[model samples]
Target: MTMRAWVIKQYGKPEDLVLDRIPVPSLREGGAEPVDTLVKIEAVGLNFADEIAIAGRYQDRIEPPFVPGNEFAGTVVQTSGSSRFQIGDRVACQVRSGAFAEYCAVPSHRLMAIGDLPAPIAAALPVSYTTAHVALFQKANLTAGQTILIHAAAGGLGIAATQLARSAGARIIATAGSEDKRRIARENGAEHVIDYRQPDWHDEVKALAPQGVDIILDPVGGQTSERSLRLLGWRGQLLVCGFASGEIPALKANYMLVKSASVHGVYWSFDRNPEEIATIQQDLVGRCADGKISPLIQQVRPISELIEAIKDLGTRNTVGKVVLAW
Candidate 1:
């Protein structure tokens, strides 16, 4: 059978995405590992990573003529006999690619039962929230009463970090490029928000947190990453999440030496520490179900408008998560 999908014939920009019909994927194709569940995709959460993948700049690069989405929600229509999930179960899943299509073949291990959580919201949880939880607790070991500075505080990952930090009893200092975005940070439990676009934004952060923040979650790289090093307290940690700013910073080792601080690169991969990831996923899913934390969705558009939706994400014109309903 055929399915409609946005195919990238070549790596370029969002405008280069092409809507095309392709065969529905099976459990094993092109020698890929067998995926145990087949899902009729209901919603997809768009990330800046999608844009990065489209431009051929993402860390895990894929060749052309490939689907470009990674996180989604769907109902299971097919499953291997030994699969834990039965047909008709609703699930949230993450894949390396192929989420932009109407149907997706997911490895059962990457699938999480989402219960009654709305599709868009379920789709929004896996990537951003997982990254936030892992970075804050697993990597940084953020403690109660500690201070955290989250960059791009209005973006999906930023908002997730803010919410998680707040729940952990950490004081939050969020940074955004605009006033509206800054306000979003505050609404999502940030104790203070700074206009990161200003030249002396780090100074402002220092003023709010004289002892330096205990943790810095930096998704906006380049100068923002460099400046964040100076904002760390004694033994502070800077968690490098992504380079949304398009420029990777060359951090100075001297800053770490002076503050006795550490730098950690945070990236979520299914291949590493399966048990730990599953534990994190289960916790996050339960939190979402119980309303302990909410995924902030800025807009929900039809999948047909994927290009426009992704363009807004790329331009930094969006706040929180953007979902595409299929």
Candidate 2:
């Protein structure tokens, strides 16, 4: 059967993607893989990484004439022989790419039931929340009662990190690019919010944490990386999540040695056993179901406006997750 999808003929800008009709994929002959699940997508999540993928700058490069999306929520129309889920189940999942379509074939291991939550919200969960959990609990070793400085606290990644850290009983100092964003950060459990545009923003953070913050979650990598180092107490850890600034920053080995601190690079897309990913998805799904975590969707655009939605993300005009809904 023919299906509608946004196809990327080349990699340059969001407008470069074109809507086209394509054939629906069938399960493999004989039998489908035990891990495969076919879903009719209802919503797709947009990320900064999507823009990077389209620009051919992502760590994992993609060839042109491809689909560009990583997270999606949908209803399972065909089961790939996995008894864990049946046809007509509502699910959400994260994949390497190819989610910008009417349907997607995801591994059953990555699929999680969304319960009664809207599909768009479910679509926003996997990538952002999983990345936050891994970065805070696994990489940075965040502990209760610690101080955490979450940069870009109003963006998708920042919001996830803020909520998770707050739930862990950490003191949250959130930094945003504007007052509106700062307000959103404060509403999401941030104890303090500062506009990073000011010249003395670091001083404000220092004033709050006093000695220094125990953990720093930094997705904005340019000068923010350099400033975050100064706010780290002895033996503090700086989690480098991404370079959303377009200018990648570097840390000096000598400086780290002087402060007795460490800089950790967080790459959430690391290869792992399907079971491991499923476990994380399960935790995230439970939290969403309990309303412990609510994704702050900045905008929900129609599928036909996919290009415009991507452009808004590229310009940083959005405060939270931007979703393209069917």
Candidate 3:
């Protein structure tokens, strides 16, 4: 069977995401059953993880000439398994690879049933929403009515975290990059939005949370992370998610000691913490269905413009989730 997938001919730039036709993969000995599933790919969500794979940056290295996407939403047109799903089930799945395709096989276990939300929303949820869910609810143990701050507040995961935290009754203090991002952040439930590009954003945050935020969700690294501690409240928890800013930040040891603040790291690799993943998903999935956390999808560019979308995200221009359509 013919399978259409976005192939990275060589890891370098978004231009390298070339559309190509390849053979549909069949069941391997260890792979799950329902081998013949046909996913009419409706939407493919982009992640900073994919950008790293494309530019040869991600720590989880993959060989060239492979599918680059990690998540997608589609209707399962065919499946051999009858226990969990019927022929037509609209679902969003988390996978290590193979989502950027006209048809992809999702091991039933990795597939999570989506609600009546549109495919675009469902497609956007799997990665960002799940990651945000893990960061806020699982790792940080955020309580309702408390306050938290999110970096990259208008990006895919940022918006998800903002909405998720807001639904939990936490006052969201969002940090964005531009005016557009600022608007998106506020609309999504940020009690206050600070543009980090400003010279004294740290002061702005300090002014808002004189006592410091209870939780700090940081993906931007380098100096940004170092300065964030100044805004931490007593016993505040800093959740270190990534280095999207392209620099690793070093914190002053005194900051941790004096404030009784703690920092935690997150590496959403499949090798660790399977059960934690389930609980996070169940919570956010329910919230999404109830319209508690609405996704802010900025654009739905076709797979052909993969390069453009990647560049937009790299420059921090995309307002929210940018998806690739099959």
Leading candidate by TM-score? 1
Q: Higher-lDDT candidate among 1 and 3?
A: 1
TM-score ranking from best to worst? 1, 2, 3
> Per-residue lDDT for 59-177 in model 3, tens only?
87888878888888889776654335567888777778888888887656566678676888888887888888888877888898888999999888899889888878999888997
TM-score, predicted candidate 2 vs. hidden true structure: 0.96
Give lDDT tens digits, candidate 1, residues 104-208: 987787789998889999999889999999999999988899999999989999999999999999999988887889888999899998888789889899899
Candidate 1 residue pairs in clash (backbone atoms < 3 Å): none
Tens-digit lDDT string for candidate 2 (239-310): 999988987887767668877999999876525555666777789889988989989996788999988888
lDDT at 312 for candidate 3?
81
Error of 3 at 294 (Å): 0.9
Q: Rank the candidates by lDDT, best first.
A: 1, 2, 3
lDDT of model 2, residue 193: 94
- Count residue pairs with overlapping backbones in model 2: 0
- Of candidates 3 and 2, the better by TM-score: 2
Q: Residue pairs in steric clash, candidate 2?
A: none
